[model samples]
Target: MVTSLYIMLLGHLINRAFYYLKQKWESRALPSPESHPASQGVLPMYPG
Candidate 1:
């Protein structure tokens, strides 16, 4: 029982770590919002 619990905890930690890394990788891969053409003037707040 204790071993199972430990395995569950380890799996949870690994899942979280992978999720964090995926977010970081995606952010780096995608273009920044400021550089997007729509962000320039299409949006009210941005006001290109």
Candidate 2:
């Protein structure tokens, strides 16, 4: 039981870390909203 709890805690921490990294990466990689066609009303839906 203790081992299972420890594994669960580790998995939770790893998931959280990956999620945080993805958020950071996406924020850096994606273009600004001003350049997005949808945001500018150029297109009713996302291009892709």
Q: TM-score per candidate, in order? A: 0.62, 0.63
- Tens-digit per-residue lDDT, 23-47, candidate 1: 6664565446457755433443332
Instruction: State candidate 2's TM-score.
Output: 0.63
Q: How high is the CA lDDT of each candidate model?
A: 0.65, 0.66
The alpha-carbon lDDT assigned to residue 6 of candidate 1 equals 100
Evaluated against the true structure, the overall lDDT of model 2 is 0.66
Candidate 2 local lDDT, 3-45, one digit each (tens): 9999999999999998787667645655575566455434333
Q: What is the lDDT of candidate 1?
A: 0.65
lDDT of residue 44 for candidate 1: 31
Top-scoring candidate (lDDT): 2
Maximum-TM-score candidate: 2
Give stretches of model 2 more than 4 Å off: 32-48
